[model samples]
Target: MNNSKKANYSIKCTVENCANHCGKEQYCSLDCICVGTHEGNPTMDQCTDCKSFLLK
Candidate 1:
């Protein structure tokens, strides 16, 4: 028998007002996140934002 657990990335986040924020650790509790752009296309990093962000 094998007993193991999958690793979950501890993503450091600064969005304090976001619902995913992990208390005072400044980390995101969500297993994964989604990013989307308002232009319907992405050509630059600034063109995207965390669509998963939910106001606390």
Candidate 2:
């Protein structure tokens, strides 16, 4: 069995209030993140938002 851990790169995030936001670094430390929105058939970037967002 492979015991090696997968590599995860930091994602640049500007939302400071998000729980996953790296302090002052503008990056997310989380290995991965989920994104979603309230409406269906989204057409723009604004239509999509972070589903993993957590209040700071």
Candidate 3:
């Protein structure tokens, strides 16, 4: 993947530690992302997680 490419403005992100994160922009490089929850019955944002996140 071209990690140096411009950010996908539609997918806003702040996790610079993610491999898909645009190096200098606060956005995700991917065209889309997957969101999932760790809890069986998620009721809050904290209970959810970014399933597409990968360690940089």
**Best candidate (score: TM-score):** 3
Clashing pairs in 1: none
lDDT of 2 by residue, 1-56 (tens): 11232323457788777766766566776788898887788888999988878887
RMSD of each: 7.8, 7.8, 2.1
Off by over 4 Å in 3: 1-3
Candidate 3: clashing pairs of residues = none
Please give, for residues 1-56, the per-residue lDDT of candidate 3 as tens digits.
44666799999999988989888788998889999999999999999999999998
Please estimate how well model 1 matches the true structure, expressed as its whole-model Cα lDDT.
0.70
Query: TM-scores of all models?
Result: 0.67, 0.75, 0.88
Is candidate 1 or 3 superior in lDDT?
3
lDDT of each: 0.70, 0.70, 0.89
Candidate 1 lDDT at 40 equals 71
Give the number of colliding residue pairs in candidate 2.
0
